[model samples]
Target chain A: MGRWEPNARERLELAALELFRERGYDGTTVAEIAERAGLTKRSFFRHFADKRELLFSGQEQLTRLIAEAIAAAPTSATPLEAITAALTALDSIFDDERRVLARERQAIIAANVELRERELLKGTVLTTAMAAALRERGDPEPVANLAAEFGGLALHLAFTRWIEPKAGEAYAKLAHQAVDELRATAAELG
Target chain B: MGRWEPNARERLELAALELFRERGYDGTTVAEIAERAGLTKRSFFRHFADKRELLFSGQEQLTRLIAEAIAAAPTSATPLEAITAALTALDSIFDDERRVLARERQAIIAANVELRERELLKGTVLTTAMAAALRERGDPEPVANLAAEFGGLALHLAFTRWIEPKAGEAYAKLAHQAVDELRATAAELG
Candidate 1:
């Protein structure tokens, strides 16, 4: 009822995820999510443009985190090293609590065509951000783009592994391992 | 009009592209497209599910072409070699005629957010197909995926270059160049 509501955004996201899981994404509604969150529809709108946006709320922040990390890598770092730094920086957000949410979110996306497409589009955007950052670091064409893609691939593989129910490795460590595996694979591409 | 028409699919696609260029994708209607193509709505429906499908009609064929090419590569071929064969196989479709259409299609997709998202989704699907094909060739987990990602990146870079107004190189040549450039870039990723 008051203008100041604590954790309104987080509450709405949790409510939406719960409703989506219980009734299916298509079966859930914005008003129902707001009601479940004990928040007003206006407050829900203030945080997310739509139900789908709730699932992807942190994309901009994640992009910024990656770009900044790549930029902040030491000048002597190779493109892959810069990418490794960016991937490691993601540990700040992929904590245990977020991992659980990620697992649920992945299942929800897997079951929905629209959400899957949106996820792919988001991945493409992140890859483009990584490439731009690499270019800014003076890595040339094709190399910058290719290295960014490798970074994107590693991030995806690491996230997938980290979200496994029984997986015990830290996200950053998994990312480093994935990048090394990809490098070895590339080396064997003769 | 007879139920059977010559070049119905191609006509519908060309008409749709022209209308989308002049009236914008959102502004153009299927009825208008059919009319412009000198056909009825029923005829248009017979050829395509909708206006968007016209631009993406060859997706299945392209997927098949790449998969079959990879599968047919020599048993001793490296993962990247198989990918190279698949890229070269694309010359069967990327002829001079398709080049013009590709340019127009790219412009239309660039101007429309929905189309751009759809394009990105298609790219992801193709990448998945490439990875699956590599896996079938006995390449390991991350290796299969990494090689496929590299192939997808090459296809994208080659396609972008091929669509440039002043580009003179053939699509297949550009594709080979892209793959080599990516390989060199990967080797330098230190």
Candidate 2:
């Protein structure tokens, strides 16, 4: 059943994720993923340079979109509103169709030491981009940097809650609540 | 040289850092470190499991102190205040005598991917402990978790600023400012 599929990237991603889950990330091979997707190893290479690239395929595009979204947010938007808008856009990006894959991706990342470091580096990249966006909006450097960092942290915490197996809160709702609580906490500081 | 040394750990740490900076982390060996410190490799291992352990030795102690400080904050303390107080205690722990080692340790961690991952894991452990402390303060579980994560992120950012080579800002002052801005950004959400 080697029928041609136009969405080879998507097919390879699904196959890789399945294989990674069943066999564990280190145990999965490029050839195995290609075979599962009804494609050759060459085709898999076309889609992803390596196994790690398969896991982070959309990272660059997603980071860019989020940065631009935050930058294009209304000037009248409060820092929290601006950050919230950006985070909500991220939620929209992680729709039901992507949630399962995202969860698997998150799990793989959490379980691996090297992947976790890359994840932190990615988070730093996004935070830096967001801070730059804020700075372009006339916010001071340190404030913009700190706001993006703290806001990103709030969003990350909320995402953790949203992804929890038994968590009752909705993603957007919990994110908003988290931002509020974070603000309140910051207010109480000297 | 070893005969006059009262603090073997301190002596070994300094020797290691100096060698690491001069020859790079991979270039420096335990034998060289021990030799430079006028001790044996056996003496070095007695104090540390390996070179990496020297980089993280203070991290464990600092995290423990922060955890305890957060847990013991006044019942009436607000979230940020409690976190700030914990960090202030941390700053005191990183007093003048410790600052040089602290900077060197950070530099070493920065230069290595594996060390950075270990450092991130260490920070994650501290974040978890801090969250447990906040939960014990009788706050709602989700809020407590979010607060702990936010505090960790803020502290990380503040530490980033403090470590900048040409940064003129004092660690305590920069940290206070960063926390203040975090509160303002949070208030903007309202």
Candidate 3:
């Protein structure tokens, strides 16, 4: 019963973020979000399990994207190399439009401890899944784990910088910079 | 009014773990833990905020230990070097007796999803604290962050192995190995 079926999900997400910003996350309701999106609560539920899911909906897709990229890396790639390649693929997932909303969403999360814990949990799961993918691709136990942790750190490093970046800055460049910093950190620590 | 007065806190910890293992964490009671430890509920509350805290009481001390170590490292140390020094300081905090209890607690946590999440949250807090300490020591923003993440990973790598370590392996040695692996992961990724 929504006017636009094709972009109902995207519209709901935008509407939800606006409401979350206008009214604190706890103060917002699904009905308000749905109404703002010109949709019904049913359509909202069909897209997201609950209000919290709006914040975390992308976690599943992001994890899958990284895992698939890791699994698809060339056979000649080293564990870190494979991971870097996988991370590079994430650069294009966000464009100019998504960046503005990402900053808003981050503010909401930073203001709430429960949301931050969920973010940490999601990060842990992403690291675990990336490690599993590397293991599946024939990496060793702890090495795979360490490499996956690096991958997670690299993505976070890049993603954070990409949040409120300069007008012309690219996400991939930030990722590469994060990768270099991680390398220097490792080398320096050693 | 119970039998044991001295080392009541220590005895309560052991007894709580024992009862948790025997009766499960959810089934065990604060009063029961107190009774098993030969102490009063007053002493139990004095030692721990709640039952879930029984397994997590060390979090505050551990965070303090790592943060103080980072803050106290030589001023000339690079961020990574400072973190290495912080990680090195952790070796003396554990003895064989504590290791046994830590393993028991980790087992209980691994068996439950909620407990696992709590453990992960504690780890996140420890990392944030370490990062904050690094920043205090004059490390630049991202450098401090990367160093803290490395520090967190190093502690995790060492602590995890120490839980089920080989008879002759040392905690500091494992920490060094983890540092080396992190370095190599970064190098390989680069």
Best by DockQ: 1
Steric overlap count per candidate: 0, 1, 0
lDDT of 1 by residue, B93-146 (tens): 998989989999999999888888888888888889888998998888778888
TM-score of structure candidate 2: 0.78
Q: Comparing 1 and 2 by lDDT, which wins?
A: 1
Stretches off by above 4 angstroms in model 1 are A1-3, B1-3
DockQ of each: 0.81, 0.21, 0.39
Query: Candidate 2's chain A scores what TM-score?
Result: 0.89
- For candidate 2 chain A, the 10 contiguous residues with the lowest summed lDDT are A181-190
TM-score of chain A of each: 0.97, 0.89, 0.94
lDDT, residue A168, model 1: 88
Badly placed stretches (over 4 Å) of model 3 are: A1-8, A38-43, A184-186, B1-8, B38-47, B165-170, B180-187
Query: Among all windows of ten consecutive residues in candidate 2 chain B, which has the lowest summed lDDT?
Result: B181-190
TM-score of each: 0.96, 0.78, 0.86
lDDT of 2 by residue, B1-190 (tens): 3555578888898899999999999999999999999889988898899998887787777788887888788989877778777776677665555556667788888889889867877776777777787778876665565666667766777777776667666677766876776666555443
Model 3 residue A58 CA deviation (Å) reads: 0.3
Candidate 2 C-alpha error for residue A187, in Å: 6.5
Which residue pairs in model 1 clash with each other? none
| Ordering by TM-score | 1, 3, 2
The local distance difference test score of each candidate is 0.91, 0.77, 0.83
lDDT of 3 at B32: 99
- Give the CA lDDT, 0 to 100, for residue B36 in model 2: 93
